[model samples]
Structures are given as C-alpha cells and as structure tokens.
Target: MKKDIILAGVGGQGILSIAAIIGQAALNQNLHIKQAEVHGMSQRGGDVQSNLRICSEPIHSDLISLGRADAIISLEPMEALRYIPYLSPEGWIVVNSVPYINIPNYPEIERLDAEFAKMPHVISFDVDAIAREHGGVRTVNMVLLGAASLILDIEDTKLEEAIGDIFGRKGDKVVEMNVNAFRAGREAGKKQMKG
Candidate 1:
C-alpha cells in the first residue's frame, strides 16, 4: 500500500526535519519511501512544503500528485487548508492549530480555514502551544508529527526513535525539548480521541 503525506508550513518551523524523521521511520519499518521538498525563501520565513510518499514497494517518483495522499500533516491551519485538494476523500488531515501567517494573504486566512474544514476526518491541535509549554516555538514540527502519529500507524515509539536519531547528537537540551514536544502533541491527540 502507498501512503502519501504532505507536510506544509512556513520556514523555521522544522517542516523538513519532520519530513526527515517520518522518512527515516518509514525506512525503519522496511518501507520504500520517496520525498520531494520545495522551499520558498525558507531561510527568511517563507513557505515550505515536503511531499513524502511511502509504500510497501519502491517509489518511482519523488512527488505526489493531486488526490493521492493518504494523509496530510500540516503545522499550520492555513497550510492544512492549502493541501486539502491533494488529499483523497478517505484521507486524513492532521492540522496544528497554530496559524501560519500567510504572507501577503493574511487577510483571507480565516476564509481559507473554513474551506479546509470541509475535508473528512480532520484533526486539529495547538501543538505550538504545547511546544511553548515545554521549550519554545521551534519544536512545533515535532508536535505536529506527534499529533499525526496518534491517528496514524507510524507509532509513537517510531517517532521517538526518529527524534533520537535526528536530534540526540545535536545536544541534550534540544533532544529533550523536541521529544517533549512530540509526546505532548501525541498525548493531546489521544485525549481528543477519547473525548
């Protein structure tokens, strides 16, 4: 089975890091995965999108076409809304409630959100707030992944392992904060599921 995921957010949100973690985890699961990323002046707070494709078989392309995604994990509400068209009707949309201040289009952000809400099985959380509670806004992408893990089968342990692999060597503090951010979002999603 092919599982296509689109991760979208603004730069500096660790969107690519999240993509890397997910891709690494998929590899660990012995799944063949391919990912494509595009940055819009990311070094200066612009948009970033990564298209990740996973399957039991090897992938032929690095990109995912419209209506083929199994899930879309977005770190910003507006970002989530932007990818709705790329999702299959049965796909899940996991959104981080933190708003991505859409460049030059901030005024229409609210309207875009309502449009995004029309998608089926949408899950939203304030992972940014959770990250802030633990450390700072920089861990937002980890939190979004945590939230998505609750609803998807990548597994919490897989994500934790990915985090350790990705950030443990960076420094102990970063590893601690990012791991906490990921777990916080995961727990919040589980709680939401129960309630």
Candidate 2:
C-alpha cells in the first residue's frame, strides 16, 4: 500500500512534529518513506509544508504532485485550503476547524467555510481547543495526528508507540499527555466520520 500526505501549517505550529511521528510510524512498519519540507519563513509564522510518501515499494520522488495526495493533514484551516490542487478527487482533508489569522488580509471565515463545505471528504474540528483542554497548547499537533489516524495505514497502537518514542525522552508525563491528545483527537475524528 502507498499513501501520499501533505502536512501543512504556519511556522511554529508543530507541523514538522506531526511529519516526524508519521515518518517514524511508517519506518516502524518497514515501509519506504520519503519526505520533502518547505519551510518558507517558518520562524515568522510563514507557510510550512511537508510532503510525505509512504509505500511498500521504493519511492523515487520526495514530492507529491498535483492531485496525487491521498490526504492533506493541516494544522491550520487556511493552510489546508492552500493545498487543494494537491488533493486527489477522493482524498480526505483532516484540518483544524479554527483559523490562524496572522495577516490583516486573511480571507473571511464564511468564504473559507463555504469552500470547505463543498469538499466531500473533510474532517475538521477545533483541534487547538481540544489540545488546550487536554494538555494545554503543546498538544495541538498531537490532536491533529489523532484526527488523521483514521486515514493512516498504520495501526493505532503503532501511532501510540510512535508518540511515546517521540516524546519519551521528555518524560512519562509528556508522553502520557500526547497520548491523551491523540486519543481525544481520534475520538473527534470518529465523530466527524459518523456525522
């Protein structure tokens, strides 16, 4: 099996962390993984994106071409929309429902919402809020990972293991916190799938 994923968000939103976890999980499963990251002005809250390709066979390219992505997992709503051209017709979008309005000319919420409403497969929720409730703002990335879990080829236990491995050095508390965030996000994603 193969999956092409685009992970997007503004700089410092922890999109890279999400990519790392996914990569680690894929590696654990003995899958070939290739990733390409664009860190445009990341330190200044600029656009940050990563293209991750995981497959049972060798991957020749690091980039995901237009309309070839199996899923787009974004930490910001607008960032998700920015990659629409990379989404396949049946691809899923797992994005935060909340907007990160750093620019004065950010598009209106209604326009963004209307566009998202047109997507046949979209899983969006207040991930930041969920993270805040779970373990403060630090867990937002984990929340996003959790939401994208449903679409991931890896098993849930593998993801949980990846989270533990990624945050293990930080201490048990941190690991537990992220695990909770992931599970909470997964539940939210499941609800979105049902409704």
Candidate 3:
C-alpha cells in the first residue's frame, strides 16, 4: 500500500518532527519512503509543509502530486486548509482545531469551523489543548501524530518506539511525556472517528 501524506503547520510547531517519526516508522517496516520539505520562512512563522510518501513498492518522487495525498496531518487548523488542494477525494485530514494566529488578518474561528465542517473526511479537534492538559504545550506535535496514527498503516507500538527513539536524547521523562501525549491524541482520534 502507498500512503502519500502532507504534514503542515507553522514554524516551530513540530510539523517536521511528525514527519520524522512517521518516516522512521516506515523505515522500520522496510518500506520505501520519500520526503520533500518546504521550509519557506519557517522561522518567521510562515507556512511549513512536508510531503511524505511511503509505499511497499519503489517510489521515484519525493513530492505528492496535487489532489493525490492520502492524508494531511496538520498541527494548525489554518495550515490544514492551506493544503486542501493536495488532498485526494477520500483523503483524511487530521488537524488541530486550535488556530495559531500569527497573521494580521486571520479568519474567524467560526468561519474556519464552517469550512472544515464541509469536508467529509476531517478529524478536527483541539488537540493542542489536549496535549497541554496532559503533559505540556510542547507535546502538541506528538498529539497530532497520535491522531494521524489512526489513519496510518504503521502499528501503534512502532510509532511509540519511534517516539521514544526521537526524544530519547531529551531523557526518559520527556520520552514518557510524549508517549502519553500520543496516547491521549490516539484515544481522541478513535473517539472522533466513531462519532
């Protein structure tokens, strides 16, 4: 199976971290993977996106074509909307409902909600709030990963292990915190999927 994903968020939101964890999990499964990152003005809170393609077969390109993505995992709600053109007809959009308002003319929350409401395959929630309540605000990215995990072909344990490996250098406490955050997000995702 092939999973073409677009990971989107503002700078410092750990969008790249999510891509790394997924990429590592794919590698653990011996799957072919390609990744292309656009860090355009990321340090200035500008749009940051990564194209991740994982498949059982060989992949020749690193970029996901327009309207061909299987999923768009976003750490920011507005950032998710920015990539709508990349989503396939049946693609899943796992995004945080919280808006990172760094822009001067950010749209109203109600309007954003209305837009997301129109999508048939959207999993939108205040995942950042969930992460903040569980661990710290820093684990929001992992929370998003946990949400994305529900749609990923990778096993939960593998993703957890990848999280451990990625955050190991920070110490066991940090690793455990992120794992808990991931679990919280996963549970939320499952609940969202059911409802």
Q: Which candidate ranks first by TM-score, i.e. highest?
A: 2
Candidate 1 structure quality by residue, lDDT tens digits, 52-104: 98889878989888988888888877777677778888888888776766466
> Which pairs of residues collide in model 2?
none
lDDT of 1: 0.79
| Tens-digit lDDT string for candidate 3 (79-171) | 899999999988999999889998899999998888888888888888978887778788888888898899988899999999988889999
Candidate 2 stretches greater than 4 Å from native: 40-42
RMSD of each: 2.4, 1.3, 1.4
Candidate 2 local lDDT, 163-187, one digit each (tens): 9888999999999999999999999
How many clashes (backbone N, Cα, C below 3 Å) per candidate?
0, 0, 0
Model 3 TM-score is 0.95
Q: For each candidate, give its TM-score against the true structure.
A: 0.88, 0.96, 0.95
Report residue 187 deviation for candidate 2 (angstroms): 0.3
Candidate 1: residue 63 Cα off by (Å) = 1.0
Runs in model 3 lying further than 4 Å from the true structure:
40-42
Per-candidate Cα lDDT values, in order, are: 0.79, 0.91, 0.89
Winner of 1 and 2 under TM-score = 2
- TM-score of model 2 (CA atoms): 0.96
